[model samples]
Each structure stands twice: as C-alpha cells, then as structure tokens.
Target: MKKIIALLFGALLLLADTEFAEPKPSIDNPRKIVFPITHGDDESINHVLSSANNVMKFYGPEKVMIAIICYSKGIRTLLKKEKKIAARVRSLMTYDVEFIACGNTMRTKNIKKEDLIEGVEIVTAGIVELVERDLKGWIYIRP
Candidate 1:
C-alpha cells in the first residue's frame, strides 16, 4: 500500500509540473504597439515619447515592439535642425522604438528628407502605416 501511494504521489507531481509550467514568450510573436504623434508642440510630443519609453521599461524589449508614426504637423517634431526633443527621440532608438515619418507630409509641408532626424524612416503615409499596423494587431496610442 505504501509503495503504491508513493508511486501515485510521484506521478501526480510529474503531471502537475507539466500542466502548470510557465509558457515562454516567442520572440517572433512579440507584442505590437503603434504611437501616432500628430501634435507639433514640445509638450505633447515629449509626453508621447516619455509614455512610450515607460511602456518599454515596464514590458521589456524582448516582449514588445514599438513604432511611432509622425504625420501632418507632427512632422515638425522630427526636424533635425530643431534640437528640442532630439535627445529623447534618439534615446528611444536604443529601446527599439522605430520612428517613421510620412513621405506625403514631408512633401506637403515642403520639408526635405535631409531635414529629418537621422534615425527616422520615411513611410508612404503616416495614416496608412498606422492603419496597416492596426490590421496586424498593433494597439494604437495617441498621447
């Protein structure tokens, strides 16, 4: 009887371990986030960047991927000549936050490609990119 009980207990422990083991996150299936910054001012833009950085800090880079789409007046935030918020924007790159500028907005505002900050990539349209990201399960953030 003692031997049977011990064997059952060992089997139960093995079964529980397999059932309750924590599942690991897949790097290929990371969480997606998109921040659409349409504001031109320092306060709103900085708030958005700060909030994005906070999210990255809380979630860790391994589990989350971040993208910022700048369009319309928000394109002004990425001007290389404009030193304001440049450091903060640069810092986010280290956390894997990608900054995408709207090509249409650049042409509409008469801003040249050379005028944009170094790390920003030019997308066809900011709104279009955001929508595509939404389709791919990215959560939208407007701050």
Candidate 2:
C-alpha cells in the first residue's frame, strides 16, 4: 500500500510539472524567440548572432521569428560604426531577423537613428520588451 501511495504521489508531481512546463517550439506555428544583449564584447555579440542563425537554419527562416534586443553597452552591436560585424548583421537581416535598439540607452549614450544600422528599430526599453515577449510565450535567450 505504501509503495502504491508513493507511486501515486510521484505521478501527481509529474502531472503538475507538465501543467506549468515552458512552452515548446511548434513546427506548424511560427517559433518566436527574443534575445536580450547587454554586453558589448564581440564574443557575446557573435554568440547571439550564431544562435539566431542556427535556429533559423534548423527551422527555415520563414518558420522562425527572431528578435535581438540591445541595451546598455550592447547597443554598440547595432551601431553604424560596427564595421567588423556589420556584414554579419546585414546577412542576418536578409533572413528577416529584427535588431532592436533601446531608446533609453541611445539617449544616455547619445545615439541617434542615423547612428544605427538602417533596419534597426528603436524600442523605449529593452528589459520591458524582453519581459513582455517572455510573458507572451516567446523563448528568451541570452548569450
């Protein structure tokens, strides 16, 4: 009787975990991903791009929607002067990946729209955008 009771409890816990499990990507539906970048280093920026590239490759560009949000020092990754990585950025854009620049960081860092890459979008706050996307069931990745 005790063994049966323990097994029942274990089953209940498994059921509970599934009830609150994180959302999984669906091939039939558009896979949503939001990556928040707060570091300005080349290594960090490259990782973010590589992850997005891998996901798009795996899912096919049309099947996945990717957004990379930059704030703090990370905003440098989207600047027009980021020559070292500009080509890579443009390459990702061809896959329809979005690059978001935080307006608050731009203001503090004195970055204008012209200072950013042509396709970059400006959002009021990066953290808030990440939070909203996560709550909406989008996968969040930071590298």
Candidate 3:
C-alpha cells in the first residue's frame, strides 16, 4: 500500500506541471490580453490595474502582453491630472503594458493629447480597437 501511494503521488506531481496549449506562450509568442476600462471611478480604475498586474506577476512580464483600452469616462485614467493613478500607470508601462486612449472620447470630453500621460497611444475608436484585438486572438478582459 505504501509503494502504491508513493507511485500515485509521483504521478500526481507529474500531472501538476504547467502545460501550455498550441501557440504556447514564450518570449517570442507571448500571451496577449486586452483590458477595457469604461468606468472613471477610482475603484474601477484600480481594479483593472490590479488585474493586469496580477496577470503579469503570474506569467512574468516578458511572457505576456497587456493592453488597457480606455474610452468614454475611462479616458480619465490616462489624464496627467490623475496624479496617483497616473503614477501607477507609469509604473505598469515600465513593464511594457500599453495604455490606449480613444480619439473620439478625447474630442467628446475636450481632452487633448498633451493632457494625457506621455506614452499613451491614441486610436480612432476604443471599442473598435477592442474588436480588432479580439479578432486578432487577443484575450478580452473587462476587469
């Protein structure tokens, strides 16, 4: 019985090893994830940031690509005026996390490119950007 139990434990250990499916994530083929932030509230913004950070921590920054698409009220998160939040964003950017802003939202809210944090990419439309990324096989996460 003891030998059998040990054998079973070894088999379980072998099964516990991490496994990746087709197109496995690696330095050359990293996992792509897009996060959409539509809410401007502090909690919501922080939550999304936290989620991205957690993913990076799990996969290691080099093994994963993360993009945060901000539109509508969510554009507030990319504003330079959001001091605390902007700092957090900047920190994430160091890890290669991309933050994208919607041009339509900026125009609607009278927000200029200079008003946003340096390094933010502006797209014609945030929703459309999300759609394109999805179609490209990037995971869409709304946290």
**CA shift at 133, candidate 3, in angstroms?**
0.5
Off by over 4 Å in 1: 1-26
Order of the predicted models by lDDT, top scorer first: 3, 2, 1
For residues 10-56, write the lDDT of model 2, one tens digit per residue: 99988874232334445567789999888999999999889899989
Model 2 stretches astray by more than 4 angstroms: 1-28
- Among all windows of 10 consecutive residues in model 2, the one with the lowest summed lDDT is 17-26
Tens digits of per-residue lDDT, candidate 1, 12-55, equal 98887422223333366666889988989888788888889887
Question: What is the total number of backbone clashes in candidate 3?
Answer: 0
Clashing pairs in 1: none
TM-score of 3: 0.86
Top candidate by lDDT: 3
Question: Which rank order by TM-score, best down to worst?
Answer: 3, 2, 1
Query: 88-124, model 3: which lDDT tens digit per residue?
Result: 9999999999999999999999999999999999999
Candidate 1 local distance difference test against the native: 0.84
